[model samples]
Structures are given as structure tokens and as C-alpha cells.
Target: MLKKIDRAAAFIQKESELFRCPMCHQQLTAKEKSLVCSNGHRFDLSKKGTPYFLKHQVQTDYNQAMFQHRRKLIMNGMYQPLIDVLTPYCEGERILDVGCGEGSFLSQLATSAQLKPSVGFDISKEGIYLASDYGENLFWCVADLTNLPFQMGSFTRVLNIFSPSNYQEFKRVLVPGGKVIKVVPGSEYLKELRQAFYPEDETKQHYSNEAVIDKFQETFTKITRKTLKYTFDIPENCRLSLLEMSPLEWGVSPENKAQVQKNPLKQITIDLEILIGEFL
Candidate 1:
């Protein structure tokens, strides 16, 4: 197998235009183990094959083990529907997955689009490190959503899945007719998980994407919206994974946790809306 750095460097070299110095906003050149810009700003590449593009370290609740379980659930095809719906909307040779955790969604979408030199970045170092496992054809990095480390008008398709949105930065990095495909949770998204944990909390039992969609509409004059709702049966093996994978787990009571562990949920909701629009 190729060393991690070996695989990542190859793609970085091929898709250098997707990157710029986050600190200096200058053109970046790929090197053996680092990226250097014309203005002398350098970002060291992790030995794991991903680059550190954040101006400073960021502390996030998303941990390595959580990402591992998340990837486990994802690999089991929990998010395949989202990927299927995203395929036809994807355009251009390259794509960017914003806030990509463990890189599973981007990896799957890249395959669907036959995208070359796909890029995925998140503020979580642990997430980015784990994402390096998919680095053979895709480049991964540690970056912020508010200040992406890429050149303006470099990408034709940008993906923001169940993650924060920074429309200003999104527009800066996308081509004139580029698209931003964002996925936000629907009211029933993960209802079972919520009922199991916070049974009486009405707020926890549901969600609303109105404000998020409203903001998206405010940014783009025109857009397409579609809701894909389904329930995924939890394989016996993935029951524990389901418990550990969600941020929802953070608020569960210890008693509730044990109860769910004793009687694993049969299925969980995957209701989400996909919002697609142009850079304008």
C-alpha cells in the first residue's frame, strides 16, 4: 500500500488550484510534506496525509472514536439515499465537501459524480486525520467553514451536508454557475433516537429546518428543495454504533442509555432536505 503522504501528495499536486494560503490568501504550491504560498505562508501536511489549514487550533466535540462509529454507520449505507439524490446535481470535474467528517459522504459522492481530485475539509483535526484514509483520489484538510482555504471561482460544485453554511465563503470559491448542495435535517430526522433518550422533551423529539432554508433562500434568488425521508433498520451489530455516532447521545441520561442498550432501537429516521442553488 502507498504511504499516506505519498497518496495525498499526488492529489494535492494535481489539484493545487483548489488551495490557497488561508492566512495570506495567496497561491499555494504543493510540496513533499507542506504547502507554501507566494507570500511565504506555510501549512504543514500531517503525516496522516491531510493538511492543517486552520490559522489556529480548534477544539471540537467531534472526537476520533465518534467519527469512527459515524463512518461505520455510513459505510453500512445509512446515508446512501442522500448520496443518490446528490449524484445528478453534481457537476464539473472537481467537488468540495464542506465540514466533511471522516470523508465517507464525499468519497461516495465523488464516486457517483466520477469526480477527480475531490476535496473535503473540516475544523476538526481528528475528523480530518480519519478522512485521510480516503486520500488516494481526494484531498483532505483541516479548515474553517467561515474562511475556506481555496481560491475563488475554483470549484463548480460545493457540498455542505448536515453542516454549517457560510454562503459568503461558498460564493467566493465557486464558479459563476457552480452549485451548493446542502442537506439539513427535517422534523423527523432521528425521532426514534430522540424518543429513546429524551422521551419527554418535545424540542428534542423534533426539528425544524425553516430558519436554515430561509437563510439559504435569502442568499440565493432561486433554489431547489427536496425532502428525502426514510427509516434505516439498525443491523444488530450497528446498534451500539448508532448509540455512539450521534451528537444526540451527548444529552442522554445514563438510565436512558442503559435502557436503549438493553432494547436496541429497530430503526431510525433519516429525514433530510437537500437544498441546491447557484453561487449568486
Candidate 2:
């Protein structure tokens, strides 16, 4: 496992050379295998061989072990269909993945397409590290979504998966001809999971298509949307991890968890809507 990790680290080190400080918007200088900035900010390359440059850390109840388990499930192609919808817009350009958790989707995007300079940023250190393991060619950073470090108009395409959307800063970094591809949960996304957490199924009220459309109308000229769905059987071992990676973890009480553990599956649903819009 250590040797495999070493190769992964080596690959990430090579990829790190392609990025600068996204926040400071400054050039990064390589110093003894670490990346540094002119303003005295320093980011060290990990022994595992990935660059670690998250300037601010926010504490969350999210345990690392849970996301590690999620990495396993995601690696198994459970999310491949989402990527198939994403790759068409990313070909032959620099792509930035905002909230790129564990790098699953973006790493797949980097390897599967002719896209150049695939970069991913997340506030979670663990997520960025796991992403490093998947592909060396990806530029992974730990940065706040609300205050992205990259220069204005730097990316041709941006990917926001199940992660929350920050449209204001998203539009700022995208070039004039750039596009932002956003994925949000559909009403029935993980109905089985919701059944385990909420009694009335009323929490579905939070997903707003109007909100998505309004955000797009403010920034993009041509907006297109599509919904994609698929099903897969999840193994019991992964059930706990799946639980932890979701907002349902916080929403579900102890008794609710016990109910979910009683029977964790029928078919896992990957229902989502992809909104693709071009910057005006």
C-alpha cells in the first residue's frame, strides 16, 4: 500500500507544478519540493507526494474514515455516468472543479478526456489528499469556495458536483467564453436514504429549480439542463461510509441510523440534474 501511495504522490508532485496560489493569485515558487508564494505563504508537498496548500482550516464533524470509505464506493464507477455528461464540455481546456470532494469525478474527467490542466479545490484536507491518490495530473488545493484564489477568467470550464454551488465567485474565475456545469440532487435522489432519515419526505422542498435558474440567468447566456439517473447495488460494508458522506448524517438521529442499518438497500439511486451554461 505504501509503494502504491508513493507512486501516487510522485504523480501529484509533477502535477503541482502547473498551479499557482489560487487565492493570492500569485506565482508559486518551488523550494525544496514545496510550493511558496512571494507574500511568505508556504505550502509543503506531502510525503505521499501531493501539494498541501490550504491556508485556512474549518473544523467539521465529518470524520475522515467516512470519506475514505466513500472513496472506495466512488472508485467503483457508481458516479461514472455523471462524468460522461461532464466530459463533453471539458475537452481541450483548463478545467476547475469547485468543491471537488475526494477528487473522484475530476480525476475521472482528467484521465478520460483530452482536457489539459485539470485542477480541483476543496476545503477538506482529506478529500484533496484522496483525490491526489487517484491521478497525478490533477492540481488539487485546499481553498475556500467563497474566496477562490485563482485569477479572474482563468478557467474554461468549472465542475460542481454534489457539492454546494457558489455562483458569484464561480462566474468571476471563468473566462468570457467559459462554462459552469452544476449538478444538483433531484427530488427523488436517494429516496431510499431519505426514507431512513425524514418521516414526511418534506425535506425535498429545499431543492429549488427556480434558484438554479435565477443563478444561471444572472451569469450565463445559453443555459441547458438535463437529468440523469442510474441504479446500482451497494455492498453492506460501504453502507456506513455512504451514510457518513451525506447530509443525512447530520439530519438523521441515532434512532434513524439504527433504522437505516436494519436494511440499507434496494437499489442505490444516482438521480441528478446537470445544468450547463455558457458565460455571457
Candidate 3:
């Protein structure tokens, strides 16, 4: 709707200072329906109310339906324990969530406190479009992770939940002493589904967070890690979403997927590591 485009215009104009031109790295000014950088690189707010910033079309398996299912799974309180862990860091902070598909995580964080500046962006336009459906306090955009569009030293906290990370880009947008809070999966994350789909494949059954954890440790100067484990009883309505939500499903055979869907796991494990670091 045209109204959605205008709804976020005021927020963009107010927080225009946080943005940098993705192409030229110049300061950007928010116009009526677009963001124009000094060198004249303009990204319009069309298709979705959010500004479109990615230079190239991103073709990925995380399509609109996947994002919809993912969002439903999140909002169903599957991530409430994870949310409880993330709430303390978000109090009164200007936060940026990279790979913030469908905006569920940031929206939940925003509900915990009043965050004047909250922005969530993903490479997929579909995800951003779905994101706009959640809340108005946050700004949604289609942005590339490798080249974030925010200025250096802009946010107090940057959130990356179950998404890819680019430490350099995150560091570039955060001020000195700002924290990076990331969520990495534990080995048993979704073990039930993994066992159902890929029981024989050792690698497929267990998530390997070794490389990612090592990278997170190496990228920040000071960091804290917390591992939280919980299990949620899947409601009947969301059973299919559980089956369709994860990218891990992409590898399963059609027959296996159908069979499993008919008898999907009633409970799911939420094993995750929360990393918080600052002073990089």
C-alpha cells in the first residue's frame, strides 16, 4: 500500500544520519519516497515500503513463503527463551539487526523497550516486505550484508540472530564500545528434525558451530558467551511450518519430506549460543 511507503518516510528522514550510500559511501538524505546519496545514488521505496539497497538481484532459497513460515515459527514463541536472553542488551539502545529476515526478532526486542532507532534489513525483498507487516517503530530495507548502508560508529548494539555475519561491516557501523550480540546454534539445535530427515548423516544431524564461534571470538576484543537450551511443544497449527521453515529441509527427498510432515516431531529443541562483545 502507498500508505506503508509514507508511514516509514518520517522515520527514515529522522534517522537519515545513520545511513551511508552503499555505492559511494556518501551521506544519504531521505526524500519523500527515496534515499538520495550526495553523489546521486538513489534508492527508492517501492514494491515494499522499505528502501531497496541491494545492487543486484539476490536469488536464494529463502523465498517469501519460507520467510512467512519462519516468522510464524518465531512468533509462536519458539524463540521466547532466546528472546528472554536478548532483552537485557536491547534496553534503550539503538540497534541494527543484520540478516533480519521478516523482522520478528527485532520487533520482539523493540517490544521490550523503546528503541528510538531500530533497523532491520535483509538481502531478500520478500523478507523485508513481510517485515513491514510486524511493526512501525522499525525501519525495514533490502540491504546486502557484505556492504551495510549505515555509517561508521552508528549504533549502540548490533543484533545478528541465526543469520550470516560480516564482522567487518558490523564493526564499520558500530561506535567504539558498541556491542555485537549474535546467536549461534548449538550442536543439538533442531536435533529432532535433523534426526527425522537425515539420521545417517552425522554432519546433518548435528550443527557445527566451531568455525563460526572461532570467527566470533577472533573478531571481537571482549566477548561473553551463553548457551541456552529449551524445548517447545509444537502446536498443531504450526506443525507444517516447523517442517517447512528451515533451510535444512532443502536437502531432504520429497518422499521423506512428505512422510515426515505427516508425523513431524511434536517437540523441538532450541539450543543456541548467545555472543555479546564490545570494544573492538
Q: Which is the winner by TM-score between candidate 2 and candidate 3?
A: 3
For candidate 1, the TM-score is 0.96
Tens digit of lDDT per residue, candidate 2, span 90-114?
Answer: 7777888888878777877777777
Off by over 4 Å in 3: none
Model 2 lDDT on a 0 to 1 scale: 0.71
The 10 consecutive residues of candidate 2 with the worst lDDT sum are: 3-12
Q: What is the C-alpha lDDT of each candidate?
A: 0.86, 0.71, 0.86
Per-candidate TM vs. native? 0.96, 0.83, 0.96
Summed over model 1, clashes come to 0
lDDT of 3: 0.86
**Best-to-worst ranking by lDDT:** 3, 1, 2
Per-prediction backbone clash count: 0, 3, 0
RMSD of each: 1.3, 3.3, 1.5
Candidate 2 Cα deviation (angstroms), residue 58: 1.7
Model 1, runs deviating above 4 Å: none
- Per-residue lDDT for 1-280 in model 1, tens only? 8888888877777778778888878899987677899888888777888888777778999999999999999999888988888888873357888999999998887778788667899999998898888854788889888878899988888899989988889899988888888899998988888899998788888778899998898787569999999999887888888999979999889999999999988799999988988845
